[model samples]
Target chain A: MPNILVVEDSPTMRQLISFAMKRIPNSHVIEATDGVDALKKMSSEKVDLILADINMPVMDGLKLVSLVRGNPTYKEIPIIIITTEGAEEDRKRALSIGANSYLPKPIQTQELIRLVNSYLTKQ
Target chain B: MEKETGYLNKADEFLQMFKKGEEFTKELLKENEKLRYKIAQLEESMERSGDEARTKLYEDRIKLLEDEINSLMERFKQVEEENKDFASKYIEVEEENNNLANLYVASYQLHSTLDFSEVLRIVLEIVINLIGAEKFAILLMDDKTNELVPVASEGMAVSAAPRVKFGQGTIGIVAKEGASYFSDNLSYMKEFNPTTPIVCIPLKIKEHVIGVISIYSLLTQKSGFTNMDYELFNLLAGHAATAIFSSRLYTQSERKLTTIQSFLDILKEKPRR
Candidate 1:
């Protein structure tokens, strides 16, 4: 019963991600419009993993990753950065800042599930 | 006196014969004891050999059973590996099914609204999320001017929107010919060029070309088009065209109805007498 937090600004993309996450066995998905919204939701819900987009309004995903890593309370939770930014530098930056994984957009749903499952099982 | 001496000699001979007979009986008794000991030793050796044979039989049977168990274990491992492969294939099929469902939902959302802006927004979303297009524009043919005009755009500067006449360029040719054009080589360059769209899909209502959807660039992550992307383009060719066309007609009719109502209101005013 892992709780997956999906942080995306676009409604369509958010719906697509949440739809895929719901297929996991007994997994629960929480939606957030942006990184700010994601941080607010994290305080209330016990999130097991985070799937965030890098380019977002207000607080971006990279900033969120840093903040989450800095906090002792939520630092252990796995964060997967799913974004359209496919550059090697972007990936390296996200990983250096404490993101667990970086997945480019146009995501294969099976791959997404497999990566999440691997992380969740580790937990 | 002679007769008494003969009798004494006979007595001596008989006593010597009896001593010889006693020695012979003692030798026979010793031989019998040795034979009995040899028989006992042979019986013990035979018993030990029988026990060894039985132990060897049991050990061979145990070895055979162990071999059987090892062979079964190997087969079990093979079956487990095959089950894993099957599970992986099932996930792939499920992912394909989900992609189809996404296409269905996108098509459904396109026709669900009659608002012109809403239709445009839905198209924008479909391209961005489904096709992974970073910059694109939707152009509609203006009936009066006979030229394609940009109705909506995403990730493009407002000054970059262009209007093209029939058979003017690639976008114009796509509009005139009603055939989709997709670039063979997708550029990784981030520069936005309005003139050279990587993909230009003409929106058509049956054989009639209504407008065109031009894609300037795709998201960096999308390396090339997929089967799903091609299916979506076909869907937009027909379904998106119909939806946009219906919405535009509805908007125009609404405006005409308001104008007619205004005329009626003026006539009913009776010249303000």
Candidate 2:
């Protein structure tokens, strides 16, 4: 089964994303309040894919991406940055730091699902 | 005696010649048999070579068929991928259509009631779900006091919401001009400040302004407004104003009827002579 880690500060947004992820066939979703919480969860459970928000309370998503890419242990895991920031610079910076993809909110449910599926099914 | 000796020598020579001719005929028959055996061996080898060539042709045809099958399988996989993409896009479009239908239903439900509190509640619900607002207030204009007072609020205390006079602050200016005010930098607003609302939409019935809807802060995930948000705001500006007005009028009419009934009961009672 694919494990999806959702990192978001807002409870509403977290619930929304988690609900959407559950629609994926045989996907298990893990909720994280922030980047620190996401890292803690990653240490315990095997994370197959990560969908994270950019602006978070403790540690931001960009910092988390850089840390994940720098570490040899978890460098290969695909990370998709979902953010309210739709600027081109934000997308470029996230991809440069090893984010697999960048998706802007007001998220389309089907689009989000399709993007995850692509990453999860990739060899 | 000389004649008889000559005849005997001639007969001996003729017998010798006849014996040599018989030897030559036997050698010729043996050579012809060897040549016939060689021709039979050559014919058998030629037939064997023809069978080998036919086997090689069948092998090449089988290899070509297998290659064609492999290429066909690759094409089938490619077409399946394309179909999946189209299916996903179709689902996305359907989802968007559902959202639009929901908005229309909500708008239709707005005018379905004349209860004052219910209308306000509906407006609040619309803003929360559609606009993604975390903190906001709906302020109505007090006719006698001529100040905007909070009738309903979310994520904040209604009593704490400010009462603004005409042309006093941002909210007041918006009410006076009958135009909506949206902050340029909504992402920077972390806390609720009445003076600088993230957005202030003036509720108007026709050309006359009635009240205002001020959003101090938005949901954390909602960093900025979308086109849908603006469209909803425009909708609330007119529909919300009319709903509130109609409900209030109904309430006042009910109150007047109660007062008149009480007066009629008092008059019907005959005074003690």
Q: Give, for candidate 2 chain B, the lowest lDDT window spanning 10 residues.
A: B97-106
- Go through the candidates in order and give each one's C-alpha lDDT: 0.89, 0.84
For model 2 the local lDDT of residue A52 reads: 91
Residue-level lDDT tens digits of model 1 in B22-92? 77788778888898888999899989998899899989999999999999999999999999999998877
What is candidate 2's lDDT per residue for B120-194, written digit by digit as tens? 888886776557787899999998999998999988889868999976799999999999999898775786677
List where candidate 1 sits over 4 angstroms from the true fold: A39-44, A57-79, A88-101, A118-123, B1-81, B108-112, B143-146, B158-161, B165-169, B172-179, B187-193, B205-208, B253-273
- Locate the minimum summed-lDDT window of 10 residues in model 1 chain A: A10-19
Label model 2 with its docking quality class.
incorrect
Second chain TM-score, each model: 0.72, 0.65
Where does the lowest 10-residue lDDT sum fall in candidate 1 chain B? B184-193
After best superposition, candidate 1 residue B144: deviation in angstroms?
4.2
